[model samples]
Target chain A: MKLLYFAWVRERVGHPEEEATPPAGVETVADLVDWLRARGPEYAYAFAPGAAIRAAVDKRHAKPEASIAGAREVAFFPPMTGG
Target chain B: MAVRLQREPFDAGAEAARLTQGREEVGAVVTFTGLCRRGADSGAPLTALTLECYPEMAEQELARIEAEARARWPLADALVIHRHGRIRPGEPIVFVATLSAHRAAAFEAAQFLMDYLKTSAPFWKQEETEEGTSWVAAKAVDDDAARRWDEG
Candidate 1:
């Protein structure tokens, strides 16, 4: 799957997008966030617990528990500030 | 209905005119423009604002919001245009225009579109000041505003 970061999350993660394969047990958005957090200090900082992060799976807004099975893209970002 | 995401600035007046050009039956036209301001969070002068978005997702999300507004209101036409990239203070960042047969529907639908766009759209804004730059944090008030639409 392709993982995307935006706003400060992208700045912390140091990149906008990347390809990654999660472990078999990583089934939901929260699990994937945990997995990314373990990749490095930057990823950890970006996905740190209590961070105001939001997610979208396949271009749709999703909650932490939303399933990501067979998804092509997942995006993580701060709560949107658009108007 | 039209939703456009662009990097260039948009003319709000032209957009509003296009929406109501030949539509005599439209009694109300509500147009809203959101602009970048000169002040930062720290009371410093903000030089510019950098706006970014997931291109495909932003377009899809805006379309979804526009569709919802149409579903809830009897709209004759609706147009949404949002700009991304570096914008100077006093420059327009977004424009929304809604036309209907009555003032109530046009006014409410335009507000609904803006409220949802504030919270759900896939755009992020970063403010640049003399000291440094920082991402603008999302406000709880915006979430509350969006949520109010769900209740009776």
Candidate 2:
């Protein structure tokens, strides 16, 4: 799946976008987040200790508990405050 | 309604005129242009700000937001333009204009667009500071502002 970062999310994650194939257990957005958190210090820092990061599946806003079974893309970023 | 995402700052005056063009009933025109501030908090000297957004996603989300605004108000027209890439302090970052027959509708729709844009748009700001580069997070105040719409 294609993963994207925005704003500070890219800064924290150290890249603007990337493609990833998650492990079998990563069936949900939460699960994918957990997997990403375990990747390294930067991923951990990007997710932070317990930040309320938001996710979007297929360009529509989604919650962390949302399923990612057939998702082609999942983007994670902090809440937006732009107008 | 028109939704535009550009790297060049927009001319709000020209945009407003264009939106209201050929509309005699549009007695009210309400607009909001978000400018690059020093910083949201302590007024830290803002050297530069960079905005990044997904081109396709941003356009789709913006169209959805504009549709919602029109559904909720009797608007004559609406226009939203946001600038991305590197920006300097005091430069315009966004422009939202609503035209309506009455002041109340124009005002409400304009505010609604701004509120939803803040939470719904994909644009993100990176602030370059003396300490270092910092990613600006979603502000609690912005959420509060959006929440106020639910009260009615």
Candidate 3:
């Protein structure tokens, strides 16, 4: 799977995108976030609990419970501020 | 309908004109432009605003918003253009134009598109000041504004 970060999430994670493979039990966006958080302090900071992070699965807005099964891309970012 | 995500600036007048040109059937046209401002929350002078977007996802999300407006309103046409990259204060950042046969539909649809865009679009803004740069936090007011459309 390809993971993307944006805004401050990207800054904290130190990169915009990356490729990673989650274990079989990582089935939802929340689980993936938890998996990434364990990778390093940076990921932990970016996906810290209570952070206002939003996620997308394959470019569509996704809830935390949204399944990531067979997904190719997932993006995480702060809430959008566009107008 | 048109959704353009560009790095270059856009002219609101030209965009509005393009939507209404030669269309006598269009009785109402509403155009809105959002601009970068010189003030920051900390009372620091803002130098510029950097807008970042997920290239492919931004386009798809914008098209989805435009399509929703079209489905909900009796719109003749709608155009949305949002700019990404560093924008100086006083520069236009986004433009939305909607056309319809009646004033109510045109006005409401344009507002609907903007409200949704503010909260749902895949774009983030960072403000630069002498102190430093920081991401603009999403406001609860914006979420409330978007949520209003869901109620009667």
Candidate 4:
């Protein structure tokens, strides 16, 4: 699966997008966040607040409880401030 | 529904003109322009506002919003133009134009689009202030504005 990061999340993660496959139990967005936070310091910082980070699955807004099963792409970022 | 995410500044007059020119069915056209502003938190002097977007996602989200507006109202047409990258104060940042057979539909649709874009769009803004750059904070009022559309 491909994952994307934006804004400060992108800056902290040190890249915009990447491909990764989580372990067997990492099935939900919340689980994914916890797993990614354990990957390294940068990932840890990016997902620090964990729940504060917003996410989109397959280009649609998704809650943290949403399943990532069979998903191709997921994007994470802070709440939008666009007008 | 025409949605564009570009770094180039768009001519509002031309865009508004193009959207309603030959469409006689469009009795009203409402346009809203968002401009970069100087200073933000702590009163630091802002030199520019840098906007960032997730290309595919931003486009998809915007298209979905446009589709919703069209479905809920009798829209003749609609256009959304949002700019990304560095934008100085006084420069236009975004433009939304909605056309419908009557003024009420156009007006409401435009406002709805703006409210959704403010809270749900995948765009981030950083203010390049004299003290340095910082991301703009989201406002609760924007969420409340979008929530208004959910009621009867």
Best-matching candidate per lDDT: 1
TM-score of chain B of each: 0.98, 0.94, 0.98, 0.97
Lowest-scoring 10 consecutive residues by lDDT in candidate 3 chain A? A74-83
Candidate 3: give the clashing pairs. Answer: none
Q: Give the per-residue Cα lDDT of candidate 2 at B47.
A: 86
TM-score of each: 0.99, 0.92, 0.98, 0.96
User: Which runs in model 1 stand beyond 4 Å of their true positions?
Assistant: none
Clashing residue pairs in candidate 2 are: none
Model 2 earns a TM-score of 0.92
The sequence of per-residue lDDT tens digits that candidate 2 reaches over residues B44-135 is 78789888787778898999999999999999899999889999889999999998889999999999889988988888888887776677
List DockQ, one per candidate, in order: 0.92, 0.74, 0.92, 0.87
Candidate 2, residues A3-47, lDDT tens digits: the string is: 998766777899988999998989888898889999999999988
User: Of the pair 2 and 3, which is ahead by DockQ?
Assistant: 3
Write model 4 residue lDDT over A1-83, tens digit each, in one string: 99999999999999999999998999999899999999999998888873368999999999989999999999999999886
Question: lDDT by residue for model 1 over B1-152, one digit each (tens)?
Answer: 99999999989988887889999999999999999999987789999999999999999999999999999999999999999999999999999999999999999999999999999999999999989899999999999999999995
Q: Which stretch of 10 consecutive residues in model 1 chain B shows the poorest summed lDDT?
A: B10-19
Chain A fold similarity by TM-score, each prediction: 0.98, 0.94, 0.98, 0.95
Error of 2 at B40 (Å): 6.0
